[model samples]
Target: MSSDLEPHGRIGVVRLGDALDWSTAPDVRTMVSTMWDDLAGGCLVLDLAATTFCDSTGLGTLVSICTDSGERGVRLIVAAPPPGVLRMLRITGLTAFFELYDSAEDALRSARAGR
Candidate 1:
């Protein structure tokens, strides 16, 4: 998997590519953790538009990130998740646990408005 970080004022957008599975989830977690200093009290948009697959490990990673973000006062938003990922989140009853948007722009706008 690949990830790119883009900062827009107080919002940090992380665009994830390829697949988010067991092998990549740890890296993703580390990447996000390392950016916490820059993202604290700001918003984080996980742009998963290019991510094609997400396994159980990926879902767990996402949940952990969301929980940690809350503790750090960072808002975690998921944008453009593929159908499979969305389905997995729903099946796991995490749809209500996360803030989701159709696109990164939408998520960014919403986060900005809330601020």
Candidate 2:
């Protein structure tokens, strides 16, 4: 799996790769944690448009990140999640816990408007 961090002013977009499973979840968590200082009080968009798979551990990592972001006053958004991931989130009842968007651009727009 691969991930890229793109910072657009106060909004940070993390573009995730093909898979977000057990082996990659920890790395993702660490990547976000490492960038926490820069992202604090801003917005974070997890760009999952390229991500094709996500396991339970990946979902747990997302929740952990969301909780941490909330505590740090950062807005967490999940953007462009594929059908599989979306289904898992819905089945797990996490759709309400996260701000979902159809694209990163939409997320950034909402964040910019302070929504």
Candidate 3:
């Protein structure tokens, strides 16, 4: 697993570099949630290009994060998810629940435009 933190313009980007499984899901959720209060505007760009797989826990955590962010008016954009993960999101009817992008650049651009 690997990861990186970066700023794509004004959006804080957290790229997960590992396959999201039961073992790492909680940590990922906690880390992102903690970062919520630290990022300016509470907006985030999640780069999931390296995320190969995810389970219900990962999806649930994402949903929880979305719910929390919505209450605080924070925008969370997920970009470049693998096919498996994307399929899961689609199956759960959550594709409409988030702003998804094909790349980190795209997500950043959209975030900037919305700002």
Candidate 4:
């Protein structure tokens, strides 16, 4: 499991691992939650371009983050999720629960634009 977080003005950009399964969910969640708490305001953009896999547990953690974001009045978005992960979201009917973008930049633009 490998990931990196980069802070953009008003946005926390997360470049996630190749696989986000049970083995990686906890750390990912912790890093993201901490970042969100630190940000106080703005949006979270998960750059899934390098992510090749995601399991139900990983998806659940993401949903948890999304839920927390709503309570914090922060937006949560996914940028460039791989085809498999995207399909899983669709299959699980979770696609509607998130803002899907082609890239982190697009996500930031839409979020800042209040779209």
Most accurate candidate by TM-score: 2
Clashes of 1: 0
Error of 2 at 7 (Å): 6.5
Report the Cα lDDT for residue 50, model 4. 84
- Model 3 scores a C-alpha lDDT of 0.76
What do the candidate models score in CA lDDT, each in turn?
0.86, 0.86, 0.76, 0.80
Estimate TM-scores for all models. 0.90, 0.91, 0.84, 0.86
Candidate 2 clashes between residue pairs 3 or more apart in a chain or in different chains? none
Rank the models by TM-score, top first: 2, 1, 4, 3
lDDT digits (tens) for residues 17-112 of candidate 4:
788889988888878877766556777788888888899998998899889989887778899888998899999999999989988678768867
Relative to the true structure, candidate 4 reaches a TM of 0.86
The clash count for each model shown is: 0, 0, 0, 0
Instruction: In angstroms, give how far residue 81 of model 2 lies from its true place.
Output: 0.8
Q: Using alpha carbons, what is the TM-score of model 2? A: 0.91
Per-residue CA lDDT of model 2 for 1-115, tens digit only, reads 3434445656777888888999989789887887778877788889999998999889998999999999998889999999999999999999999999999889878988889
Error of 4 at 8 (Å): 8.4
Q: Relative to the unseen true structure, what is the C-alpha lDDT of residue 96 in candidate 2, on a scale of 0 to 100?
A: 95
Instruction: Please identify model 1 stretches exceeding 4 Å from their true place.
Output: 1-8
